[model samples]
Target: MKFLIDNWYLVLTAVISGGLLLWTSLRGKSAGVTTTEAVRLLNREKGVLIDVSEPEEFAQGHAVGARNVPLKLLSTGEPVKQLPTNKALPLVLMCKTGARAGRAAGMLRQQGYTQVVAVAGGLAAWREASLPVEKSAA
Candidate 1:
């Protein structure tokens, strides 16, 4: 007790950090892949990236070669309209932020997509990493 009292700041800091980690985990905000990792997956494993943003946001800007599949359509089992039929193929989901992509990843898994993951920071992270982005101009 004496040691704790002397180092109260350290103990409080440790407790707060542990609590934050626990809260994030309980909230289902677990980590995902980085832009570099996504690129590696794409180049080495032929992974497909699906943007879960609306068509308008997709047209605004997205990872180069990403397909727009909107979250609502995915929730309805639409498979992004042009998704490949192979369940074994890897599918990477992305959004403006990582939140929607996380939800879409769960839906894809429920739809029997064996390999699905969300980009850690979504398109914003991709852009921050200096990766190429494309637009539809529509």
Candidate 2:
């Protein structure tokens, strides 16, 4: 008790650091999909790739054969409802850096999609890997 009282600042810092470490581990477990894994899913699982980038960004360049759903449309639940494929098909969600894709994946799972995957690192990583991209007609 005396030692803790004398080193209260150190004790507080240690407690805060431990809490942050625990939070980080928990957060890391929820991360979905890496670029390599996503490619495997594409080739092996035939996952349907859905680009969540905005129209303008998507027009600049996007994965070849990827369908654009736009993050805004997904948030509003309109685009997903219009998706042609059945919900059971494996769906791969992708965006600029993957943050939007993660959100979209969670939204899809909540909507009863069983096999939704977020493409980690998203189009940036895809482009970095020299993968093919298609330019939209302006």
Candidate 3:
């Protein structure tokens, strides 16, 4: 069309922008839960919070009641001894930001975890929400 040809730059920009938006939305949808939703799952569905930080980082501070299972362990593709054997239990994963947790969630899903979600914004978001956090005694 004449109008599209005349404004090809604008049309291209719009198309690229739309593609980026669609990609982000689709990528984000199934990968994470907000702090509030994480809390609801923990309280209402008895979800287990799994912190994927390294031992040193986890001991610094982590979500209260969160169990530490380093990302390295999960990456090995072997059974993580620290993880609960009941895959039916909802597992909420968190890390410093959300990146590691997202990868960890995907790994867990591959392992047949029926209900797994990463905490959006991870532990930083949890702290931002003023949720309880505790340092390891060791």
Off by over 4 Å in 2: 1-26, 79-84
Checking candidate 1 for backbone clashes, the offending pairs are none
The positional error of residue 14 in candidate 2, measured at the CA in angstroms, is 12
The best candidate in terms of TM-score: 3
Tens-digit lDDT string for candidate 3 (1-138): 999999999999999999999999988886699999999999999999999999999999999999999999999999987898999999999999988999999899999999999999998999999999999988
Clashing residue pair totals per candidate (backbone < 3 A): 0, 0, 0
Q: List the residue pairs that clash in candidate 2.
A: none
lDDT of 2: 0.83
Superposition TM-score, candidate 1 onto the true structure: 0.78
Model 1 lDDT per residue over 35-129, tens place: 88788888899999889999999999999999888898888876555677998888888999988998988898998988888999899999999
Which candidate ranks first by lDDT, i.e. highest? Answer: 3
**Which lDDT value does model 2 have at 75?**
74
Q: What is the lDDT of residue 112 in candidate 2?
A: 79
Worst 10 residues of 1 by lDDT: 25-34
